[model samples]
Target: MAQTIVCINNAGMIMQFWIEWVNDDGTQGWTQANSGDYPVDQRRSLDMDALNSQGESIPPGRLVRPHVQAVAGASIAGDRYITYTPGSGTAIYDVTGTSFNYSVTLIQS
Candidate 1:
Protein backbone atom coordinates (compact mmCIF):
# COMPACT_ATOMS: atom_id res chain seq x y z
CA MET A 1 0.00 0.00 0.00
CA ALA A 2 1.16 3.51 -0.71
CA GLN A 3 1.99 5.76 2.23
CA THR A 4 -0.72 8.29 3.07
CA ILE A 5 0.19 11.64 1.55
CA VAL A 6 -0.58 15.14 2.90
CA CYS A 7 0.22 18.58 1.53
CA ILE A 8 -0.10 21.79 3.58
CA ASN A 9 0.29 25.42 2.62
CA ASN A 10 -0.04 28.79 4.34
CA ALA A 11 -0.40 32.06 2.44
CA GLY A 12 1.22 30.26 -0.51
CA MET A 13 4.07 29.16 1.75
CA ILE A 14 4.37 25.58 2.84
CA MET A 15 3.76 25.92 6.55
CA GLN A 16 5.67 23.07 8.14
CA PHE A 17 3.58 19.92 8.15
CA TRP A 18 2.54 18.48 11.49
CA ILE A 19 -0.06 16.39 13.32
CA GLU A 20 -2.31 17.25 16.32
CA TRP A 21 -4.30 15.15 18.76
CA VAL A 22 -7.89 16.13 19.58
CA ASN A 23 -10.69 14.86 21.78
CA ASP A 24 -12.72 12.25 19.95
CA ASP A 25 -16.01 12.95 21.69
CA GLY A 26 -15.80 16.72 21.06
CA THR A 27 -15.60 17.04 24.80
CA GLN A 28 -13.79 19.88 26.62
CA GLY A 29 -11.70 17.70 28.96
CA TRP A 30 -8.95 17.38 26.39
CA THR A 31 -6.72 20.46 26.17
CA GLN A 32 -5.93 19.61 22.58
CA ALA A 33 -9.57 19.96 21.62
CA ASN A 34 -9.89 23.77 21.47
CA SER A 35 -6.81 25.08 23.26
CA GLY A 36 -3.06 25.02 22.83
CA ASP A 37 -1.47 25.81 19.50
CA TYR A 38 -4.24 24.47 17.35
CA PRO A 39 -3.39 22.92 14.02
CA VAL A 40 0.20 22.66 15.20
CA ASP A 41 2.77 22.32 12.45
CA GLN A 42 5.48 20.02 13.71
CA ARG A 43 6.68 18.76 10.29
CA ARG A 44 5.58 15.15 10.17
CA SER A 45 3.21 12.95 8.25
CA LEU A 46 0.31 11.32 10.03
CA ASP A 47 1.39 7.78 9.35
CA MET A 48 -1.26 5.10 9.49
CA ASP A 49 0.74 2.33 7.81
CA ALA A 50 1.46 0.70 11.14
CA LEU A 51 -2.13 -0.45 11.38
CA ASN A 52 -2.90 -0.36 7.68
CA SER A 53 -0.24 -2.72 6.37
CA GLN A 54 -0.86 -5.37 8.99
CA GLY A 55 -4.63 -5.33 8.39
CA GLU A 56 -5.17 -4.24 11.97
CA SER A 57 -8.37 -2.34 12.67
CA ILE A 58 -7.98 1.43 12.72
CA PRO A 59 -10.39 4.26 13.39
CA PRO A 60 -11.63 5.84 10.20
CA GLY A 61 -11.37 9.47 11.25
CA ARG A 62 -11.78 10.58 14.88
CA LEU A 63 -11.64 7.85 17.50
CA VAL A 64 -15.05 6.72 18.63
CA ARG A 65 -13.97 6.36 22.24
CA PRO A 66 -12.72 9.44 24.09
CA HIS A 67 -9.04 9.39 25.06
CA VAL A 68 -8.61 9.42 28.80
CA GLN A 69 -5.57 10.67 30.72
CA ALA A 70 -6.83 9.54 34.14
CA VAL A 71 -4.28 11.76 35.90
CA ALA A 72 -4.36 15.40 37.08
CA GLY A 73 -6.46 16.94 34.33
CA ALA A 74 -7.37 13.99 32.13
CA SER A 75 -6.85 14.15 28.40
CA ILE A 76 -7.22 12.08 25.28
CA ALA A 77 -4.49 9.80 24.03
CA GLY A 78 -3.42 9.13 20.41
CA ASP A 79 -4.26 11.21 17.37
CA ARG A 80 -7.92 11.71 18.01
CA TYR A 81 -8.00 14.69 15.67
CA ILE A 82 -5.96 15.69 12.64
CA THR A 83 -5.71 19.23 11.26
CA TYR A 84 -3.95 21.11 8.48
CA THR A 85 -2.34 24.47 9.00
CA PRO A 86 -3.73 25.95 5.83
CA GLY A 87 -2.44 29.02 4.13
CA SER A 88 -4.58 32.05 3.40
CA GLY A 89 -6.13 29.95 0.66
CA THR A 90 -6.60 26.36 1.82
CA ALA A 91 -4.99 22.95 2.32
CA ILE A 92 -6.26 19.88 0.60
CA TYR A 93 -5.18 16.22 0.48
CA ASP A 94 -6.46 12.71 0.06
CA VAL A 95 -6.54 10.46 3.05
CA THR A 96 -5.29 6.87 3.10
CA GLY A 97 -8.99 6.23 2.94
CA THR A 98 -11.78 8.45 1.67
CA SER A 99 -13.01 9.20 5.15
CA PHE A 100 -9.90 11.05 6.28
CA ASN A 101 -9.56 13.83 3.69
CA TYR A 102 -10.10 17.33 5.14
CA SER A 103 -9.23 21.00 4.71
CA VAL A 104 -9.05 24.15 6.89
CA THR A 105 -8.98 27.75 5.74
CA LEU A 106 -7.31 30.41 7.80
CA ILE A 107 -9.48 33.31 8.88
CA GLN A 108 -7.84 36.58 9.82
CA SER A 109 -8.41 37.18 13.50
Candidate 2:
Protein backbone atom coordinates (compact mmCIF):
# COMPACT_ATOMS: atom_id res chain seq x y z
CA MET A 1 0.00 0.00 0.00
CA ALA A 2 1.20 3.51 -0.77
CA GLN A 3 1.23 5.39 2.48
CA THR A 4 0.92 9.16 2.68
CA ILE A 5 4.17 10.28 4.17
CA VAL A 6 4.51 13.57 6.04
CA CYS A 7 7.32 15.19 7.90
CA ILE A 8 6.55 15.76 11.53
CA ASN A 9 9.23 18.40 11.64
CA ASN A 10 11.42 19.64 8.84
CA ALA A 11 14.19 20.87 11.11
CA GLY A 12 16.67 18.28 12.29
CA MET A 13 17.47 18.53 15.97
CA ILE A 14 18.27 16.39 18.97
CA MET A 15 15.19 14.65 20.35
CA GLN A 16 14.46 12.12 23.05
CA PHE A 17 13.03 8.73 22.15
CA TRP A 18 11.59 6.08 24.42
CA ILE A 19 12.34 2.47 23.54
CA GLU A 20 10.03 -0.18 24.93
CA TRP A 21 10.62 -3.89 25.43
CA VAL A 22 8.66 -6.96 26.44
CA ASN A 23 10.22 -9.55 28.69
CA ASP A 24 9.83 -13.33 28.48
CA ASP A 25 7.11 -13.19 31.11
CA GLY A 26 5.01 -10.76 29.06
CA THR A 27 6.00 -7.74 31.13
CA GLN A 28 6.77 -4.48 29.30
CA GLY A 29 9.46 -1.95 30.00
CA TRP A 30 11.09 1.05 28.39
CA THR A 31 14.08 3.28 28.54
CA GLN A 32 14.74 6.79 27.31
CA ALA A 33 17.49 7.73 24.88
CA ASN A 34 18.69 10.80 23.10
CA SER A 35 18.07 10.67 19.37
CA GLY A 36 21.27 12.63 18.91
CA ASP A 37 23.25 9.65 20.13
CA TYR A 38 21.40 6.82 18.35
CA PRO A 39 19.82 6.22 14.97
CA VAL A 40 16.29 6.83 16.24
CA ASP A 41 14.95 6.72 12.70
CA GLN A 42 16.02 3.10 12.30
CA ARG A 43 14.22 2.10 15.46
CA ARG A 44 11.08 4.03 14.58
CA SER A 45 10.98 2.52 11.12
CA LEU A 46 11.21 -0.98 12.57
CA ASP A 47 8.51 -0.31 15.10
CA MET A 48 6.17 1.23 12.56
CA ASP A 49 6.74 -1.63 10.16
CA ALA A 50 5.88 -4.14 12.88
CA LEU A 51 2.70 -2.29 13.68
CA ASN A 52 1.65 -1.82 10.08
CA SER A 53 2.25 -5.48 9.35
CA GLN A 54 -0.30 -6.26 12.03
CA GLY A 55 -2.82 -5.28 9.34
CA GLU A 56 -6.38 -5.65 10.62
CA SER A 57 -5.68 -8.27 13.25
CA ILE A 58 -5.88 -5.57 15.89
CA PRO A 59 -7.44 -2.13 15.94
CA PRO A 60 -4.99 0.55 14.98
CA GLY A 61 -4.39 3.35 17.49
CA ARG A 62 -5.64 1.39 20.44
CA LEU A 63 -3.69 0.80 23.62
CA VAL A 64 -2.27 -2.69 23.99
CA ARG A 65 -4.09 -4.49 26.75
CA PRO A 66 -2.51 -5.48 30.11
CA HIS A 67 -0.34 -2.47 30.78
CA VAL A 68 2.95 -3.60 32.29
CA GLN A 69 5.31 -2.19 34.88
CA ALA A 70 8.33 0.01 34.35
CA VAL A 71 11.78 -0.67 35.69
CA ALA A 72 12.23 -1.51 39.35
CA GLY A 73 11.13 1.36 41.52
CA ALA A 74 10.32 3.25 38.38
CA SER A 75 8.99 6.01 40.55
CA ILE A 76 12.52 6.72 41.71
CA ALA A 77 13.51 6.79 38.09
CA GLY A 78 10.83 9.43 37.56
CA ASP A 79 8.75 7.09 35.43
CA ARG A 80 5.46 5.60 36.50
CA TYR A 81 2.97 3.24 34.87
CA ILE A 82 5.04 3.01 31.71
CA THR A 83 2.88 1.78 28.88
CA TYR A 84 2.54 1.89 25.09
CA THR A 85 -0.54 2.97 23.22
CA PRO A 86 -1.30 3.77 19.57
CA GLY A 87 -3.20 6.84 18.49
CA SER A 88 -3.21 9.78 16.07
CA GLY A 89 -4.42 13.38 15.92
CA THR A 90 -3.94 15.05 19.33
CA ALA A 91 -1.93 12.80 21.63
CA ILE A 92 -3.57 12.09 24.94
CA TYR A 93 -2.97 9.61 27.80
CA ASP A 94 -5.43 8.46 30.39
CA VAL A 95 -3.37 7.92 33.53
CA THR A 96 -4.64 5.81 36.38
CA GLY A 97 -3.39 4.69 39.80
CA THR A 98 -0.98 7.09 41.45
CA SER A 99 0.35 4.34 43.68
CA PHE A 100 2.71 3.58 40.81
CA ASN A 101 4.76 6.03 38.80
CA TYR A 102 4.44 6.14 35.00
CA SER A 103 6.32 7.25 31.94
CA VAL A 104 4.12 6.51 28.95
CA THR A 105 5.28 6.57 25.32
CA LEU A 106 2.54 6.69 22.70
CA ILE A 107 3.26 5.18 19.30
CA GLN A 108 0.86 5.96 16.48
CA SER A 109 0.20 3.33 13.86
User: Where is the poorest 10-residue window by lDDT in model 2?
Assistant: 1-10
Per-residue lDDT of 15 in model 1: 28
lDDT of 1 by residue, 9-44 (tens): 222122223323235655422212211121223222
Q: Over 4 Å off in model 1, which ranges?
A: 1-5, 8-10, 27-45, 50-109
Q: What lDDT tens digits, residue by residue, belong to model 2 across residues 64-100?
A: 3222222222321212222233332322222223224
* TM-scores vs. true structure, each candidate: 0.25, 0.22
lDDT of each: 0.28, 0.28
